[model samples]
Target: MTSPQPAETRTQKRSAQTATLAEIAREAGVSAPTVSKVLNGRADVAPSTRARVEELLRTHGYRRRRAESTRSPLIDLVFHELESAWAMEVIRGVENVARDAGLSVVLSESAGRLTPGRTWADQVAARRPHGVILVLSGLDESQRALLTSRSIPFVVMDPAGDPGADVPSIGATNWQGGLAATRHLVDLGHTRIGAISGPTRMMCSRARVDGYRAALETAGLPVDPGLIVTGDFHHEAGYRQGLELLRRPDRPTAVFAGNDLQALGLYEAARELGLRIPHDLSVVGFDDLPVARWVGPPLTTVRQPLMEMAEAAARLVLDLGREDRSSTATRVELATSLEVRSSTAPPREGRDVAG
Candidate 1:
């Protein structure tokens, strides 16, 4: 007969098999009830103690076996901000998926921060939604840990930053869109082209700018740093930057506005300077928003499938929550195409194509 195993060794084996709330509490130097409160996301728990308990739970790979009845019939849709019409397209997409799934959507904003606050995480844990879909927003390590412990899956859409390799995400082919936009301008005989870019911190924005550079390089055109102006993906920033670019002594005959809104702003600036669309200045924009078509002259733009991307993100998050499904990190980028319209044209007669 084999000798009995040591008590300490036996305890270790039990822990490996199943980490209990009491064991986690003991490791965290807190009471079992306190650990439960943290797990349940009770607001009464102190921030410091809650964080400690959460860390311990994560360290032990603790996963709460939640009952089906415990989850709310809802999907959480979070955003960094809800300031633009661009958000409306995303909302419509998520809403379509959520409606078909028989689940309502809970919308939240991080109020300009890239990551939602701790309070938002706590609220999410308490509500126990089926899954979460974040648009242009990310989560902190602690927030991710909290969601993981509760087995609540999340997917990022058009991530503002590099959402790690382990995070599921959905985005558009921004680089390809940018490259196509610039190439179209070049093909139109506009050699001196300018660009208005979105915020530099955003990966999508950076990729778009990079594509623009690539297009110019391939065309044997000079990449003039002085002509690329940075904007905040807002109409005002576009208007302001457009003015600055147009005021230059050697202004570009064509410009690629990062998105449709900026393109509109650029339109306003051109009007103020007595320039005619496709005549004095040719312009291209991205995100082919509906307003792009209604504007004075239909705006030439890149079509990013915003609605489709949001729908995919929502569906992916729900799939991750299914026990039978694998929750591997998945990144999907939809294709972007250029929609040539009346906004772009050949450079004027006197403009130098080689300049």
Candidate 2:
């Protein structure tokens, strides 16, 4: 008589042949209810019993009915738009985390809109991603509920709006960054500072503007309402608002822009008026995009650590996926630092740059 074959190998082969859940339960020497709990990842099952049942299911190749395999190694990334260098930075960060984990990223945009379309969530649900990382985006109640029900974890990065106190999210220190940017300008001896801000509805934008106010108050300078203008955080808005600010009789000697794109637009406005950087006027911006360094005079701006924030969000979502139930909501705000480049200096004495 031949020696008995290894039990696990024999079971593996049998599973490949076609084994029902009942058969797996019988082989694992557990009741069907216990086996069901293990299959569903229910916490009520004892560790040893769940392990035994899982081993049997793995060996027997049992596929749960009407459910996609939970082992999908794909991560979904949702963005408001992928057209900007800032967006590219975020993508690179997420990709770095995904590559290390032996996973791939699927990119989605909200139809070139800030708010996601209703069907976008449904499509994501259908894909059954292992996890999701949303950049400057949000989910409605139904969408959030759907993902939760399916055990798909997600994290928000630089959420466009308030992501709620209970939602997991990662963001930069926008308020601190704004304060630093304005403070840098003030330290350079420019008291008459103007600011072109991003959309007021976005939390990040509001926080940044608030920081600017805080810095001004700390320095004993009254916040000038006329000097602050709201824009959409684009080159056009920056150029338009920059022109308006520069045209004033008591033009600001230094201007703080919400982002790098807007800063470049300000550069154009200053150039049009024949004003020399750091000599006639100084400028500061947020989000030190690569273009900031390559400009005529490198931009003095706030470095928001976009890539690091994205990486953190991606890692958090994956970790949430592995956990049965995270006890508390997670929120992370990476520090933002000032990058002093060649774009700022003290106001010129005796003569107004705008004239």
Candidate 3:
């Protein structure tokens, strides 16, 4: 009898049983093109058909070829939450690039969480997409490892936290945006400025808040702790914080909101309290979203290049997917500019009283 093969050799032998595209297609009762679509994580595939194909692929122990040959024609776009105008801007940007590259985009949400669930990595590996782009999120160790093992590259867009020094990411100059917003209020002759900040846990939030403080200090204004409040970067939180700030007898003549959503909430609060925009209080918001211009009297806000950042991220991930990937970590931060509009003006004297 032949000597028993080593345990590692036997395991490798078992996993080496790979099936061809035609074989997988025949077994799944689908055309070769359908199998190829499923393998590429194309969004056009039907749920039932994709599931059947994926199951058949797993059963047959199918493995994709190395990146040196060819790559899947799909890109994965994962988001922390899918319910916002912000998300839409990013999606449009990525879609623009993917369309030019003749690649399909696959969208997935992390269910309102900072990171995706455990099975997310496995599902992505099974599909073998060309690349992955995560918005306001990061991958865990195992997820990173899984993608690395399969030679699939990933990029982070506006990461929520420290994405480590090695990971590539795209973001805007949030600090400069915050500084510009606050400085605009100062230039409008507002000595007292209150700020509504996003969650302290997020890097963007902290950067904006820091810039606000820096601008205040630069103008020889005292940075009052009471003038600053943290928010969850939502309309509800903005509304609640706006009520608090506007109710104060020593309220500031102007308020700088961390984002457009919060600024809109502040507008509602000011209306309920019988205050007039620019006449009684001036507000500045960040992100300069489309609604910023459509709001009543329009919003004077900092314009962040969200779509451009997304497009850059999409391009970067695709570049990383090439056979000869760059070892250096690439970090790109787009510039931010202030869009002066009708929402801001010189503060009216004696308008700091409760609104």
Candidate 4:
């Protein structure tokens, strides 16, 4: 009804031929792949090539299609095992972060019996997730190489040392936490401190013991060789260690367990020996999990920032596609707090507090 608009000025008229991306690239003297790479902001393209393609895109008024890009988004979360409640907390952290950033998580658990590393690697390679997050402390060299080799952005939680790869790491400072727990007991004048540690291969076990030693030295107390017991990080190990320590003519007045799970075992050992806590013996633990607070006497222990660490790990892996390495290869050490309860006190019956 209004005057017929000319073809050049008609906004409603259908154009038979929509411009294709390849035609635009041909006009810019570059391949269609270059235009696609630059338009998508993929990291695989070199700086010069990316720049050239971007310049052409701007000149040609090319725009990125958001609908297609946002259609398929997924991430991968890998762990040695997922049985513990604490681990579940970390998982929740990861899920919260990823979901907020418009992503869904695919989970994998490495059985961790012998070739779990290689098997996990093959499985991950087959899936090709946008990014990966690892929660295993015992990750082997080949597995690390595979991740880096594939140019996949990954993050590791609770890495022991070096991490030996380009991935970022997020975890609580296990060593410092142990030191804090032991130092608290040492300050309370419990000189004979016995420990129930985890597996030797685990960095957590080694770091925690190191903290125990550091506290003893700081207090100018001689580390007692007979009092130190190495048990699995289970309650049974704690019970066995407790039995051995209680049998000594000079028994430890306080015990520092590697984890809360082991601390429960130590409590059983005290019951077996007819010793009263903070009366005849004292006990402290690491990883102040939810159960630690509910346990008898409300276990005095060190707490790890499980949620915060998980969030940081998630961010590191999610932001990997960005040009800046701001979030990649980062190492964050969260602080630990010591929760004092009725489990510790100065030795009784004229037992000299080792200083």
Give Cα-based local distance difference scores for all models. Answer: 0.90, 0.82, 0.84, 0.70
Ranking by TM-score: 1, 3, 2, 4
RMSD (Cα, Å) of model 3: 9.6
Expressed as tens digits, the lDDT of each residue in 182-221 for candidate 3 is 9999888888899999988779998999999999999999
Q: For candidate 4, what is the total of clashing residue pairs?
A: 0
lDDT of 1 by residue, 92-117 (tens): 99999999999999999999999999
Instruction: Tell me which residue pairs clash in candidate 4.
Output: none
Locate the minimum summed-lDDT window of 10 residues in model 1.
Answer: 1-10
Q: Estimate each model's TM-score.
A: 0.91, 0.79, 0.80, 0.74
Error of 3 at 171 (Å): 0.5
Clashing pairs in 1: none
For candidate 2, lDDT tens digit of each residue in 1-355? 1244567875665558467778988998888887766554556878888667756665555555433355567899998887667999998999999999988999999865766775666566556677888888888765665455455778989978888765799999999999999998888777889999999878899999999999999998879999999998899889999999999998998899998999999999999999888788899989999999999899999998998998888888887876454535478899999999999987888653344
On residues 122-178, what C-alpha lDDT tens digit does candidate 4 reach at each position? Answer: 556445566788775535655554544344567778763346433467767788888
Question: What is the descending lDDT order?
Answer: 1, 3, 2, 4
- Of candidates 2 and 1, the better by TM-score: 1
Off by over 4 Å in 2: 1-69, 324-329, 351-355
Clashing pairs in 2: none
